[model samples]
Target: MTMRIVAGIVISAVVGVALAVTASYALATSNAPDREVEDAITTGNLRAGVVVEYGTR
Candidate 1:
């Protein structure tokens, strides 16, 4: 019974770590961009100032 409890705890910790890592990776690799900027580009209304702002970043 003690061994079973220890195994359960270890498995739970590993699963929790895996979930945290996956969530972090998903956020880090996201391709979504700013909606307003995307709309401006799509409509051919993008401004020079916007480009400069992004460039400085």
Candidate 2:
């Protein structure tokens, strides 16, 4: 349905933004420019749980 498609798009976009911000925060805090992000932390399952994990900053 159109509503479902729109919701999916919105959710995907939001997740993408969250991934970017979290990655940036981790990158900034770690102070390791040479190290890749995947080596820093896994950005999977952007739920309330993961949000709490990333909320330390």
Candidate 3:
């Protein structure tokens, strides 16, 4: 019975970590911008952070 409880706790911790990682990646992707837009702002072949788009039409 003790072994079973320990196993369950370990499994739950692993699953929780996985879920947290997945959620973080999803949020990161949503905030990230495309490569081209980033290039225009930096004026170099650099890439990072969110890329915001603006239009005058």
Candidate 4:
């Protein structure tokens, strides 16, 4: 009976961890496009500024 209880606790913990990881990954992918857009705009502006500065020299 004690072994069965321990086994049940271990199984529950593994399942809980799996659910948490899956939920976080789902949330991250869902929000990824906004992050990509922000990054692209910042990188593009930086690159353009560098190019113009070098071109002027």
Q: Write down the lDDT that model 2 would get.
A: 0.72
Please provide, for model 3 over 1-57, each residue's C-alpha lDDT reduced to its tens digit, 9 standing for 90 to 100. Answer: 999999999999999999999999999999898866786778865458745558434
- Encode model 4's per-residue lDDT on 1-57: one tens digit a residue: 999999999999999999999999998889677754686697764644343333232
lDDT of 1 by residue, 19-56 (tens): 99999988976867777678778979865655434543
- The worst-scoring run of ten residues by lDDT in candidate 2 lies at 48-57
lDDT of 2 at 13: 100
> Model 2, which residues run further than 4 Å from truth?
32-57
What TM-score do all the candidates reach, one by one?
0.53, 0.53, 0.59, 0.57
lDDT of 2 at 26: 90
Question: Which stretches of candidate 4 lie above 4 Å from their native place?
Answer: 34-57
Model 1: CA > 4 A from native: 31-57
Give lDDT per model, in order.
Answer: 0.82, 0.72, 0.84, 0.78
State the lDDT of candidate 2 residue by residue for 1-57, as single tens digits: 999999999999999999999999998878754333453456543546432343343
Q: What TM-score does candidate 2 get on C-alpha atoms?
A: 0.53
Q: What's the true lDDT of residue 50 in model 2?
A: 34
In model 2, how large is the Cα lDDT of residue 29?
78
lDDT of 4 at 7: 100
- All-Cα superposition RMSD per candidate: 5.6, 16.6, 9.1, 7.1
> Clash number for every model?
0, 0, 0, 0
Residue pairs in candidate 4 whose N, alpha carbon or C atoms collide under 3 angstroms: none
Which numbered prediction scores highest in TM-score against the true structure?
Answer: 3
